[model samples]
Target: MRQMHGAWPKDALPHRIWDESYMELQHATRQHEFVTSLYVQAKLNTRALLDQVIPAYEGVFSDLYSATSLQVLRAVCKDKWMRRRL
Candidate 1:
């Protein structure tokens, strides 16, 4: 036991390094998953809010969250704001 304990310092370094690296990779993977989930949840919440606010938009745009849809929405909102100001 004493001999093994004495050799532990020499043996532990290389052996333990990989375990730390693997743990760090796992932590990074978990963080990425958490961030992706939050993004998906935000998209779902946005869709739900849009359903209540502009349910007709879904019928008009095949994908309500597409680039073209967003651009059209921006243009419409700008037009509305301009009209309101006038």
Candidate 2:
């Protein structure tokens, strides 16, 4: 981004890092939900809250998931979501 925007400053580094993490976590959570939602379309009557992973999923951060992504969303519904596990 800096190449065209002229150079990212040192002071913006921390914010940039935080922003990256926030988006990553959000996406993982979303992916988990997406799968379950699709499963719901199949009418399995399952229950799982894999969307709320406490420890958070860990994997490669990349602009292209197919290229460098090593992460996999593990659907595990605990608490209220446990009742719907299929």
Candidate 3:
């Protein structure tokens, strides 16, 4: 057991260090969550944009352009085996 000293400083160095570390960890966690949320939102927006854009140009473009666009789109949006090759 430790004896209490009334004259000791209430905001000791160790306690201040621990509080600072805890605040930093909490701030980092919040930042990570914010970034992850943004990434998910961007992904969803990309998928939606691809859905709207792909069909509009599919048959109107030249064969090479059409094929490459489709291949790239599939690689980003699907889990097919071709995605592994990309």
Candidate 4:
């Protein structure tokens, strides 16, 4: 034990290094959770806008819009198959 202690510098305790790493991991986890929450909120808002608001203009601009684009958006947003592709 004395030899081991002598091998490392005074400021370089293994326990202290482990504690600092643990603290850094905890901080990273909190940051990941915060970013994930923001992503969920943005996804929910986009879903709401796509599902509820865009349909209101469907009839008015039915002839002006491309059928293929509308179909692809509906598939990716509302259908399960395209969502799996995402």
Candidate 5:
């Protein structure tokens, strides 16, 4: 009985390691999925707002989210605002 009890911890070590590793993996996977969903939702909301604000935006820029397109939009808005002030 003493020998069996001493060997039990050795036998259980691998199982304990596997269980903890699996739980860690599950936590990481859930965090990744949550972040991905948030990104998708943000993209959808941006598209919806752009469509309402500038119906012809897509006709001008092949990639609406491109840096160049965004810069041009900022410049144009700034020009308009400046003209209004003048």
Candidate 6:
């Protein structure tokens, strides 16, 4: 098992990296749009939306999640997973 101390980044690193990448994605708005549009345009497998949308949104959900401090997110995510399975 990897030692807890080995190369583990500081706590801030995750938030920092997340913020930077979000900014980068925002900058490359076209790529972001393409990925999203592709998902929609193809009428992706309903299961795809239910299983994958949260992960695709994972990169940006934290901010709004923090503000809301609600379980709706979990429910919504679970619904997606359920739809995918059904």
Top model number, lDDT: 1
Better of 1 and 4 by lDDT: 1
Compose the digit string of candidate 2's lDDT tens values, residues 1-86.
Answer: 33433355544543434577899999999999999899776533211222133323232333312333323332232434666664
Runs of candidate 3 with Cα error greater than 4 angstroms are 1-18, 55-86
TM-score, candidate 6, is 0.23
Quick one: ranking by TM-score, best first? 1, 5, 3, 4, 2, 6
Best by TM-score: 1
For residues 1-86, what per-residue lDDT tens digits would candidate 1 score against the true structure?
33355446544554534577899999999999999999999989978887887888788988877999999889988998999999
Which lDDT value does model 6 have at 77?
Answer: 69
- lDDT by residue (tens digit), candidate 6, 1-86: 43455457444233344577787878799787888998776645643553464455544555433645236567776888999999
Tens digits of per-residue lDDT, candidate 4, 16-39, equal 445778999999999999999999
Q: In model 4, state the lDDT of residue 22.
A: 92
2 or 5, greater by lDDT: 5
**Which portions of model 6 miss their true places by more than 4 Å?**
1-63, 66-70
Task: Flag clash pairs in model 4.
Answer: none
TM-score for each of the candidates: 0.65, 0.29, 0.46, 0.43, 0.61, 0.23
Q: Give the TM-score of candidate 4.
A: 0.43
- CA lDDT, candidate 6, residue 39: 76
Q: Whole-model Cα lDDT per candidate? A: 0.83, 0.47, 0.66, 0.68, 0.82, 0.60
Per-residue lDDT tens digits for candidate 3, residues 1-86, read: 44446755554433344577899999999999999999989867765675585655445545423667667766756766666778
Candidate 5 lDDT by residue in tens digits, 1-86: 23455547534553444577899999999999999999999989977887887888878989877999889879978998999999
Residue ranges of candidate 2 with Cα displaced over 4 Å: 1-18, 44-86
What's the ranking of the predictions by lDDT, best on top?
Answer: 1, 5, 4, 3, 6, 2
